[model samples]
Target: MAQREAFAGIMLENENMTIAPGAAEDDRLDYFVHKDGLTFAGTHLIIDLWGGEGLNDADLIETTLRRAIDVAGATLLHFHIHAFEPDGLSGVAVLAESHISFHSWPERDYMALDIFMCGKTDPYKAIPILREAFKPETLQLNEIKRGIVS
Candidate 1:
């Protein structure tokens, strides 16, 4: 007996199910196959901000986070911010979708930020908020998709 799996007009037998180099495009499997068709899971943004001002202010950090949550279309649950010994701030904004967090190094004029959101929220929308708040001369950004789909 032979087992078979079919996807996007491509049929595969258990013994010879290898995918050819261009099979995905030919069969259109990329269109229909995903983690789950029903959910997008979420997006995580890792941001590095450099040469920014006001990085040490806890009040400013918290306010910026609040604005970021609003811009990202994520619901805020709670928030906490702490100022460091000399001149730094750490903050977290808990959201219904996920969270946004940051740690600042005022001495170097740098800040590390994380923004994670799920569901229908658009995490990328927070970029403008961060830019306006930090005024970074240089920025590095990385995006990652999160969640497991069956």
Candidate 2:
């Protein structure tokens, strides 16, 4: 069985594995990006989809997220989703660069999303894919360059 660790109401489950001496592992500095004389940790995008379709469809949402992740050049580590009691859902895709997460309210035809990526990954590339898949009537987007260094 895998081991579970808990902190602040959040739990992380990990599989049992042994490391080889010569194995390549734990490299994160390579994930940072440098652009236009500035170095930053990642690009974070806040997206809101109002009056959208298929927000309640878990399979379509997952497929769309996978397609967006692939198109954005981000490596997906794991993906998980949960459906609510009535008509809502939430999901997260943990990626090598960062993560893409969202919560949907099907009754309201709305969705909130956060897409963040680091290193050589382009988070903006996911926008079009998401827009096409969700088909929102009103879309709002904002961007932040996280961990900037002068």
Candidate 3:
């Protein structure tokens, strides 16, 4: 299926969403990521999934959140999700780096997500994992670099 992928500050289609062959599965994050010649706090990503599949599935949402956290090398402190009447859910996975929060509108096949991580851990690494899991027809992302001290 054709899908959109967005991260950092760029947008690409399926081409950018694939986990490259021979890619290292684990990242050795011994320190926080320093950005642009400064002491950077972290990266924050705002993600939107339109026309996505399984937006109403709370179980799938929780599972995907866990998987994304692992792939991004973030530490999970706590996880909670609440499914609502009709068809929708809101959840969050608290992480040492930050958090990944989810709010789904199954009525419109849309999902919104927030991913933020501190240190050398690669927040960018989680994008593809989410693309593969949600299979959204259109994906949009915006990135913000948090806490930079020159």
Candidate 4:
């Protein structure tokens, strides 16, 4: 006997809905949307920040996460953060409705961030918050819309 498929939809049928390999994951967050006949679809953002003071490791990470949640319209559920004191390398995964995650490093003055949001959640709004949080001398961002093949 063959296993039967559960949900049916172009969004789920496509590889677009699946999260990328080696990407950040947040087990605490589970997004559910049932409206407009569309469910389990959303956007993800990857941000790279450069140029910030190397001394203040804890402050930058805390401030960045808070701003991303409060301003980006992302509902943070839970998070895990690891930082290298001398090198100023920080990694964080923020469990959220849109999705989870952001990272920062004060020593090298660099960071990589990813934010995923579904349903009515808007990820772009978080930009200003990030801008204020990192105050990077140079910032590069990549946005990917996750849903549907066609």
Candidate 5:
């Protein structure tokens, strides 16, 4: 009997593996399924927020991040926030699975966020919390899957 599997862009046939045509070598193992056969390592969300409100308050930022963590069903280990000079905020929520972080420029009404979570956590669930907290006029989001393939 022969078995085949496709991981990222590479094809595994029995004991032989080959990269799919036009697939970059570096992209070969960007995503893969775990041994349990039901989960990947994690999901990474890169978000750009524009014309948002409350981007300067460090307290609000921390609270919102906590809410996001809860909404995503992730476990929080610790979190920290810094209020920038004049008007801005930066923070990170460290989770057992991974982390959620952001940098905000209140003067420009812009914010950038990275939310990465692994091990059964659904990072996409945090989007609604972010929308309610920031109320951004424009939102740009990108999702990437990260893991190892064997």
Candidate 6:
């Protein structure tokens, strides 16, 4: 009876495992261990960046947005920029593979940048690059993950 129980236990363990080391085995291993293709549901970031010297240039804002799209491999569907009396503001929304976005307020030496991307995209890279380009005296960054119920 003891030998029979041991054999049954071994059979059960093997039954839960795969026989071949093919795609199915790989998938099983991934499901049991690796998290390679796993991704976040979505990410929303609202950034209030303040600048000091020459950060309010319209050219700079345009260049930064264009460069960001290139670097992130994002798609720019539409953009709206307004330069007010005291300061200028530029807002752009890009339709990216990960998600959508908004960037604005470069006239008053301040800009607000909001980015939302789902799946496999990296929005964090934009922050350090923008910090260097804008040279803000003070900055505020807010990040919120959206649509992550499961």
* Highest-scoring model, lDDT: 2
Overlapping backbone residue pairs in candidate 2 total 0
- Which one wins by TM-score: 1 or 2? 2
User: What would you estimate as the lDDT of candidate 2?
Assistant: 0.88
Which sections of candidate 1 miss by over 4 Å? 1-40, 148-150
Cα TM-score per model: 0.72, 0.82, 0.76, 0.62, 0.72, 0.60
Is 3 or 5 the stronger prediction by TM-score? 3
Which portions of model 2 miss their true places by more than 4 Å?
A: 1-26
- Higher-ranked by TM-score: 1 or 5: 5
Q: Ten residues in a row with the worst lDDT in model 1?
A: 27-36
Worst 10 residues of 4 by lDDT: 1-10
Error of 4 at 30 (Å): 11
In TM-score terms, which candidate is top?
2
Better of 3 and 4 by TM-score: 3
Give candidate 5's root-mean-square deviation (CA, Å): 11.8
lDDT of each: 0.78, 0.88, 0.81, 0.60, 0.80, 0.58
Global fold similarity of model 3 (TM-score)? 0.76
Q: Which 10-residue window of candidate 6 scores lowest in summed lDDT?
A: 27-36
Could you tell me the C-alpha RMSD of candidate 4 in Å? 9.0
User: What would the C-alpha RMSD of candidate 6 be, to one decimal place?
Assistant: 16.1
Model 1 score (lDDT): 0.78
Q: What TM-score does candidate 6 reach?
A: 0.60
lDDT of 3: 0.81
The C-alpha stretches of model 4 lying farther than 4 A from their native spots are 1-40, 54-56, 105-107
Q: List, residue by residue over 59-87, the lDDT tens digit for candidate 4.
A: 66666666666665666765665665455
Model 1, 47-74: lDDT tens digits are 9999997888777788888888887788
Compose the digit string of candidate 6's lDDT tens values, residues 1-150: 776555542423265353332234443321111123433456667888776444446677767766765565566766555565566555555553444344445455666678775544556667766777777788788877665444
lDDT score of residue 79 within candidate 3? 94
